[model samples]
Target: MSTTEDLTKDLSRIMQLAASDPHDIGPLLNYGLDWMLRLAPFDLVAVFLLESDHLVVKAARGPLADARVLRHAISLDNFTSIREALATCGPRLFYEEDHAHGEGDPFDGVLDFPHGHACMVIPLCFGGNAQGIITFDRERCGTYDSQTIQLVEIYAQVLAMAIHQAAQSQLLHQLMRESNERERILREEHQAGDLLSPLQSKNPAVRELGERARQVAPTPTPVLIHGETGTGKEGIAAFIHQWSERRRQPMVKLNCAAIPESLLESELFGVVKGAFTGAVKDRPGRFRMANGGTLFLDEIGELPLPLQAKLLRVIQEGTFEPVGSDRTIKVDVRILAATNVNLQEAIGERRFREDLYYRLNVFPVQLPPLRQRLEDLGPLCDSLLGRLGRRLGKPPLLLSENTLARLRQYSWPGNIRELGNLLERAAILARGSVLTPNLFDLSHSSDVKAGVGESPTPSADASAEAPMISLDEAQKRHIRMVLNRVNGKVYGPGGAAEILGLKPSTLQSRMKKLGLERKVHFEA
Candidate 1:
């Protein structure tokens, strides 16, 4: 048994907890039950809150139950004593002798234990309102002294106040979040369009690009389309094939960067049944599938040096021998390659072969980024919004004039793909027919300079505007800076890999691609 001083300390601790202004109601229920059980000799104690119309067990403790015993619940209709406690806003004591078959036992049909011989349900009340009942049960059929009951009632009052305050705070936070999101939606606007079909824009640059593709479609000369990521290089390749003589034949597509180096050769050329382990069946690679048609190889710059020589051989002689086979298969396939990588820089780094570059770059087509082609924004939005709205079950989505102006001022790092995705998201969030987006909704914020690739800002030393550095150059600087900070440690805690959030193997691969060998950069 605890002394009078101990009980007084517990009451004060609960009172202080109620005054602390908590955001969650769970802690109050748990802490209150811990103290309530100590006031009397109790084998079981559980707190239940009236949520909607059901009395749900929120927190509990006993030899038969753990602190997280919230899986039990009962409706007020099935709980006569609990309903009486909530209705009178007072505590009611009961015994097994008074109710036959434990008809109104709070834990009846809820827990797989006896109702015990004696139990009581106390209404959790504050400000003349009640939300739930707290249950106390004991093994022996007996009475709780008036002093103990009085002490428990006082604790209940403090607990009820604490739960009320925390619930109000929780409700307030939810409302504030909803209110903030609504306010943000009202302040910005955008419209979207789909690019599943070919782009026929009013812009002369876009028109000329389409005409150029049509002109080259008739020739056997290989073409390479190059641009920043998300500028739609794949679309250009498809457009050329659509107008080509081999349009009826299959135009097989492969992304050279997506596959591992060890298996890349097998993917490009056919593989025999016993080429390598797990090669149980012979497979005709992408080249054989696209025979008599066109083969579009995206991210061609990522092709390994050894594979590059083989790719060149296929282009020159139109012949390739499958792995682990002596027979040579001939295919008259026209290759169309695409790359975001600056291959000139890749060749200088020796990551890309110089001979292979000339073979693929027979004719090059550079697609202008979305930021440079603002003339197409209005039409693009109108076209994409209708498709997006219909797809999302919100038809005919529209954009404001102010949104178009805002779009022009911002630099689009992801280009047209980013633009389409942004619009689709806005349509999903839009309350009505009009869609609005927050000004800084883009992945790259406003600080990213506008027309980044179109024209570079002037250098401090030079009188003329300096060209923007290539993406590879930027990555090299960032990686080297981290390496220097870690004293050139490539693995382990506080090393370059940890700082960069990259696996050591992945870091090694990137370093190799950028020609950043350990001996060359770290030691030389």
Candidate 2:
């Protein structure tokens, strides 16, 4: 047994170690155990910290020091000695020899302790509150004396102060980390809001489109957005996803036309390990990643017929098998599909599935071409310049009156995308801040030639004048003239669609019926 002088020296050493490094609880517990063994050798020593109503073993010595044993928790209701010590804010002792075996014993032969042993549980109290419990166990009976118990009670008080300070510091650090994460999320949301602000246009067609988007955003119904290429169909899909209830979750996107047909199936549905050549590991597909969220499939018309049927299954049943596995995985993904091709015409040609079209066309949102919404041109130009100027680290470029007039007269076939590209190019060429009409390189553009609404000047000879033609002949002549001016480019910017004010699909159908071959090569 340790004398009073020896116990006093040990307590001083423990306090010194704790004062030097208060954050490290391991060293303090180690020194306390050393002193405890000198007073009365124990089979096990466990220090359990009080976390709410449960005791979590923070440190342990001897046979019970294993990770699994240390992690085990003890409820206050399960142990009378631990509960008594916490209630009295002092120490309590329990001996197996003093209790009956079957019905009256507090341990009841079920507790994980040494058989036929004595235990001393001292509650570590500081500031009139119990912080933790330090338990000591010995194989022999009557191991704890009154003097040893009194010394340990003093040691428990010092340890409690150190533990309470450390816990408060850890909690503060956790709060700071969470605060930083919230700030980062807020900043990203602000930037995304600025990017979508320009979509709110004053044009009647665009306002109607916004209204339609808001109407369908809160539901699970699939939406199909139709427009010409570069008409912001994908942007509308993004707006719907952001406004939906699933906005907090991720929105996965896949461009059906950008990926190859052979790889499209595996990309949409996940693949297991050894399913195919070079597929060494299991990979999750976009559907699984976007579970409980939204999935935007762009250029959905480009999906092959075989995959289209499989896609319809996912839409109808919310379940699909991987490319090579027979296991069917279930997901709850809301789909939003976009396409520039005319599905009705494709259905007539027997190229697109009618049932699949009906399934995807739950709510159709059509975006008008830039030419049809010419009133928004000036605002769109200003919005684009402001955004692009920030990205380029330069001031926003101003458009002269002549340059703005020319832009308004020329038909925009590529819609907002073409206008944004033109502004970006002009901004780069602009000296200081002003942009002139001469900076625009539209000399070879067919839209520029047609916008003037006049043909090349004829020679000053009266004999060169031709007679007036029939309306049917005149329409044919005009179609052939624009097609020739653009060198047969009919679909994209500067194509016949821009000059004729028609969709690409409509123009292709008209040309085919008019017996006009589309093999004429044009400069892109």
RMSD to truth, every model: 24.6, 12.7
Give lDDT per model, in order. Answer: 0.72, 0.72
Q: What are the per-residue Cα lDDT tens digits for candidate 2 across 407-506?
A: 7655677888998898899888777687666566655555553423222342223234233333334344456667887788888888988768788988
Question: Where in model 2 is the C-alpha error above 4 Å?
Answer: 1-192, 195-199, 449-524
Residue 81 of model 1, lDDT score: 65
lDDT for position 491 in model 2: 82
TM-score per candidate, chains pooled: 0.46, 0.51
Q: How displaced is residue 115 in candidate 2, in Å? A: 51
What would the per-residue lDDT of candidate 1 be over residues 96-117, giving only the tens digit for each residue? 5545654557666554444436
What overall lDDT, based on C-alpha atoms, would model 2 receive against the true structure? 0.72
lDDT of 1 at 142: 74
